[model samples]
Target: MSFRRVIIGLLCLAGLAVVLDFGAAAYSEYRVSRLLRDGSDLGADPEVTFHGFPFVAQALDGQFRDIDIRARAVRPDIPGEILVEAGLIGVHAPLGDLVDGNVRKVPVDEVHALMRIEPVELGRLFKIPDLQVFGPPADKSDGSGGSGGTGVTTSGPIILTGTVSLTSDTNPVPGTSDSGKPVSVLADLRLDADGQIQIVATDIYYGDEATPAAMVPEVNRELVLAKFTRTIDTRDLPFGVRPMKVEASGGQIVVEGVGKNVTIDLDRLQQP
Candidate 1:
């Protein structure tokens, strides 16, 4: 064979290899997405991306270095839809099961997921009108100069703003003579042991102005404070991931968690 012919043949082989690799990646993504959709019953299609080169080799080894799945507008048994992004690390699934469409269970070494809850949904959860949640401010060194004593300064407090309805029958807050009226409030957002979000009122002001607490009737102030001192259940998160942190920012709530050794079935992805 001529040297030029040999070079052309090698180039053709290289091109064929590239095409095969691309096909393998696409197939892998399809299989994973189908498996997740069948297992999770997600509302929309789940996007799956297999990391690393030569996806077929990873399939042969029955282990993947990383797999990312983004599920959009997932409607769980919660108040509203949430967007979930799951990162599956060290996923193990045999090639035979995947090919035969018998992938019953997938084991992952470490799983991290983020669920985004919009402000409208948060309002529903809090049962408040015109509710808006903001993300926590950046942590900063304590501005208070200590006496160089045993006290150490840390981060600042988290402040959140929202509106709450006050009623005479249920809660007769002092400032409003009307039975039911909307009151603006500033509260602190936190998570409890049962993975629920807690809202504790810090200050109650009139309208958008920072009115003095004394100006509002003491009885009404207490009632307003009591209205916001409640915990919201957020344990209905998907993928059985534990709720770790809750952040309110950009008129949305972001809940993050880590899942360890989660097992998902292929048959229940589309169910309610």
Candidate 2:
């Protein structure tokens, strides 16, 4: 064969290889979406992206360097829905399973995820209408330095405001004559040692009028405690990541965490 012909043939082969590699990557994405949706009860199809070129080579090695999946409106039998984004590292998948068209399990070395829960959904979970929660700069108390220089120091505190129902028999609100009267209050958001969310009413208000906690009655305080305290379960998050931190920003709650050495099955994820 002529040398020029040989060169042309090699170029064609390289082009074909590139096309095949792209197809393989596309197939991998589809398979991952199906696996997560069918096995994990994900609310919607997750967007999966495979990192690195030549996915076929990664498949042969039975490991992927990086994979990302983003899911929206994920409702995992939890009280509220959240948007979840996960980055998986060192994912292992068997070539044999891929050939058989049955991807049973995938194990990952590490998984990092971020979950965003909107304020509206949180309000619904709390049974409060039109709830607004945010972290505002705390009041800066006047201070004096050792040299007698006056200054101010700032603190951070999370505040939550909502109309709380007073008619509930279990925990009735005090100072309300009518059953359906809604009371507005500014509550403090705190996390307990066990990672549970606790809402404590620091001040109560009635149409811009401040109500003293003493005059609110003891039963009303108990009502506030009972109505606002909630425990968030973090054991079984998406991709098995445990929630480590929670923050309020832009009227939403952002929870972020990481998982180590987790195994997932496509079939099990589909179960309720």
* Leading candidate by lDDT: 1
**Can you write out model 2's per-residue Cα lDDT over 80-179, one digit (the tens) per residue?**
5677778889988875575355766678898877776677677787787656554543334544221111121111244455556566556545534333
C-alpha RMSD for every candidate: 6.8, 7.9
In model 2, where is the ten-residue run with the lowest total lDDT? 146-155
Can you write out model 1's per-residue Cα lDDT over 1-272, one digit (the tens) per residue?
Answer: 69999999999998898789879888868876776776676665688888887777897899989888777654544477767777878888886786467767678787776777776776676666455443333334566332221122111233334545556566555434343444545567667789887777777644322222223456567766675566666654556667788765455656777878777544433224
- The Cα error of candidate 2 at residue 235, in Å, is 2.5
Clashes of each: 10, 5
User: What global local distance difference test value does model 2 have?
Assistant: 0.61
TM-score for each model: 0.70, 0.66
lDDT of each: 0.62, 0.61
Best by TM-score: 1
